[model samples]
Target: MRGGDLVVRVLKYLVSVAFLALPLAAQADELQEAPAPDAAAPVPSSSDTILVTATRLAIPVDQVPASLTVLDKPAIDRAQDIGVTELLLRTPGISISRNGGYGTTTALRIRGAESEQTVVVIDGVKLNDPSASSGGYNFANLLAGDASRIEVLRGPQSILWGSQAIGGVVNVVTALPAKTLEGSFDVEAGSHETVSARAAIGGKTGPLAWRLGGQAFTTDGISALAPAFGGKEADGYINRNVSGRAVIELAPGISADLRGYYASSQTEIDASTADSLEYSLNREFVGYAGINLDLLDGRFRNRIGYTYTDTDRDNFNPTRARAQTFDAAGHNRRLEYQGAFAIAEGWTLLAGAENERSRFRSASPPAALATPVPAPVRGGADITSFYGQLSAQPIGGLTLNAGLRHDDHDRFGGKWLFAAGGVLNLPTGTVLRASYGEGFKAPTLYQLFSEYGVASLAPERAKGWEAGAEQHLFDDKLVFGATWFQRKTRDQIIFNSCAATSTDALCFVPGNATTRRQGYYANVSRAEAHGIEAAAALKLGSFQLDGNYSWTVAEDRSPGANFGKWLPRRPRDTANGSVSYAWPFGLTTGAAIRWSGKTFDNAANTTVLDAYTLVDLRAEYALSPSLRLIGRVENLFDETYSTAIRYNALGRVFYAGLRGRF
Candidate 1:
């Protein structure tokens, strides 16, 4: 049978299974609807910190059955990182590859999963661009500014998030207003003629709270390509961003929220060689409106929201006399409802429904020839999904979570996903956790109906499992954790060369194309990724030490000639360590080191990137009660490293800044 026929059969079976399980789930839910009874409070063995992404509800971070990390404002400030990429690089089980310096394409891989497989949420808005070659968020222009916190959830998380969550989820929460009226400003000057300025004002008055912030940054960066690649000119980048948020109490137990963000950038990049002059202008926008209601005297909580996102990119090759160029835009609109109810003592049920519509358009302007611009490729798709999760603490020191989701896509019919996990508190500050999850990614519009598109392709699928243990010592001041995880993916999409007789719907050669290759997207057989992550943290007096190490083996296990080969751009080993001290005299100092082992740049492992290590230092001093001075040196050793072949990495650089609040 053909691939299309097989997909239809599997989809039918999946649909039947999903329907069969719903009644059983409904019955189970009914049993939990008994009268609420007071249950004995469970003893807390883990930290009290909370994370919202683990189950779409606030819960203790350490109690989560999967490995995760949280970075608060203080931690982010002390890190002294300029961009999101730098901030996430210190995290365990994460690796990064940048084509050039700031503002260039930067890709992140978590636990051996590809960049596009990870989901990014900024203030409740998804940032993935459906029009891009690979459907993922571009981290190049995402400068860190006024962020309250960041949460990284590793492993599959499709039960809460809809799609493209095979790797994990990264949630960025922007700063919000405090109870007291306060405002702050920051200005910085650095190497490479870089300059940055940021300011924010926020306050809470009565039952209303509001915050407004803006940031501007510019830099004359290093050549994107190495000297050998004919790069002799420096690329420059500039970014401007503004955001606002407001929340108002509507009733005794109700609240309303409104938020919006806008960011734009103009970046110069090298195309093919250093001699080429290419530039791109990109803009992003996100808007959200939501309402929250509390019922049953706080026993049940519900939130309904609407989100809209727009991403646009325009690229120009100025070197060409005619300034050849192309532009694309993508829009995503979503409506969602979430509810968390205390079904019974020691048990909570979380459920939600999401309806999303995505649209894309792309066009290439006519060149020097007196020709007309071609019509844009336009397409749209919709996905309707319903999901539910149950968290139970039937006994002391034990927690269990189970979730399921059913998604109905306009083009591909329906599919179901499942995830389950548990955490057990052991004796004397020890905890054990285990989790298993399944994920799926629907085909993007460009892959489904555009040129070289395949409408018959099925969604890519993944299954992941992890187990870990943690120990707390010294009155919970010091902690250590170790986790092992593995994931397997099937039916990955890849482009293949096609011949004249090819009957595939996606195979085609345009009249204006330069190459003779006609290609189409096809499903690759299989791949596997497994890894070990270990972390430790110690706090003594005014000093703190933190470190982590990861060993990843991402291989192409497909049934083909490249089987058993190393996956491109995934390093076998990565490690990070940091130490900091705060003096009684309002002075703080920190130092950190990051290292990455060798990695392959190609599927066949022919091209390689050697291992390299970098050292960074940061210091801060309180000049006054509400004033501070900060300085940092990145790449102290000026080590030469290549995350991507022939791409130059930033060397030793210095930066100094001042911040004040009123």
Candidate 2:
């Protein structure tokens, strides 16, 4: 009866089992009075509408204005047997952190920000990693079965993405080409002896069309963390990945794409306590090419890009025999063109322009003459942005969205971001929304020239606002939503306290000499993140009840700090729910629950972590008509908690897989 009364008795037993399964999920949607003569038959797809391109404009996630989440492609082939951080932690303000297991180096945080402030795009290029000391994009060596869809955009998208997006954006779209001539393959074995395999092929000649795929995974991990100078043994780790992609339609609407990827991993670090036999090996390589054009008679659209990233880090220790290699490489080329003009009836017009350049280099391996030596850096940066957006519907159901962007930075020089949103369509299918935005982030190169034994760094900025409402009942089968937000930041590059003497040689520095970080940082701070989100989806027929609840009060008003604490890791309550079933013998069952509340880990909120709930179960069986067999049981009551706070999570896990189509 401790730990806040066991998180209030597990949130009162999940709100009393979601109100006792709400009358058997509302009597399984009534309509069973003898109607069985070969019933389950309906397959003619052409619109249940769920198309999204994360606002690079290709709307329809209920007309996206913001806060979008889509995981299509049959839910990524039914969660491909878990571990893309368990399918993005079952979504809902996403959060994932891993320091060990399944490829190490995995971190993603959204809504509470950080992880290079979120911006990872593939197929539209931009995959962070410039020696990623923080420009995040190590989706733990991403190989989620060559993702065909994954879009998550939540709050502050820097006005159509520019500059780390200030906490939002994750797009990985791939797989297209093959209207016919198909293929498929799979193999699996699980439970810590995990063996896996996947394959694919597609075609169409003359007028060209193509598709290709590949996958490989390995694991031996679990157990490795004990080195703030201590000891630990048998760290266990291994991972490998390979990928390839191609799509060409060339002509009649033009299309072209090429992709290649490589990954490598190894980890085991305790690095001290008389050197507990240390180890660390990390490697990554990526290449991409793109082109998409569809013109006028088709409403004009164009995209061109090139991207390459390389990373390598190797550290082996036998009592510091000194081997700590380093490598980081990046290249980006861009061209974008957009258009939409039906400027007469109900109006629509959007525009775009972008030019980018980035380069970086870092090298290390010259210290151990007993420490004290650092220097080896190279840098480059360029950005040119211009954007425009407008949408209108003068009357009928009213909707108007506006956007503007202008960014030019070679080094913190120009900024202008803006957005306006609206959605008001009420005739009982309610919806009324509002939005405002401006966000920015710039200054990294180890924050403008790295040097820790001698001090130097700076760059941070932001501004934002939002408002919303939505509802739909018994036709949309019950759905609801609400949102409110606000943000403010300015030159907030922190690490304060510098003013000391006593033969000051920067006072023999090595961090926190009462804090020393002010390389052009300004602090007139303010932060107020307000929120209230509610959702419901009920389509009873064979049982389906989805739910969501979020309540946040992220605060921080600075003068001397700690205005009302509660910023770091921002969690003031969150929830997610699910209850699904489909049984006519072919079976399909589901159950899910997730919750998080107490959060704080610095930023004056004073360390605290206690609030947790996670339960997941899934099942599917249909061994015919293109086969299917899936199973999942993650943390299903084996809960030993720790979604980060010394990090260690993965206690009750099981996965089964099988899929086929041809």
User: Among these predicted structures, which one has the highest lDDT?
Assistant: 1
Model 1 C-alpha lDDT per residue in residues 1-662, reported as the tens digit of each score: 23244335444543553454345445553433311111000112233554444346666665588888888767888897879778888999999889888999989989989898999888777778878766788888888876667778999999988789999988877776665787777889999999999999999898898889999999998888866678789988999998888889989878888888899998888864555578889999989988877664555566667789999999899666557588899999887777666666557777777778888988778766677777888888888887888888888888899999999898989999999999988768898999999999887887775666677888989999999999989877899999999999998887787887766544544443444336767787578999899999999998999999999999998888899999899999999999999999999999999999999998889999999999999999999988899999999999988898888789999999997767
RMSD of each: 6.4, 24.4
- For candidate 2, the 10 contiguous residues with the lowest summed lDDT are 34-43
TM-scores for all candidates: the values are: 0.91, 0.31
What is the C-alpha local distance difference test score of candidate 2? 0.61
**RMSD, candidate 2, Å:** 24.4
- Compose the digit string of candidate 2's lDDT tens values, residues 1-662: 12243334334543443354345334443321211000010111246766676677665555556666677766666545434556665666666656545655677766655667678776556667655445567676676665667788777777777777776788776665445677665656566565667667776667665666776666554554433323234465555666666657678767776776666766664422332455667776667666655543343344444556666666666554455644455444444444443334445555555656666666665537577435666666667676767777788887777888877776666778888777777888888777676777766554444433222333456666666777888888777676766566555454334444443444333444544432222234455566665666777687778767777676676666687687676677778787878799887888888888778766787777667898888887888867778777866897655544554455676767776766
lDDT per model, in order? 0.82, 0.61
Candidate 2 accuracy as TM-score? 0.31
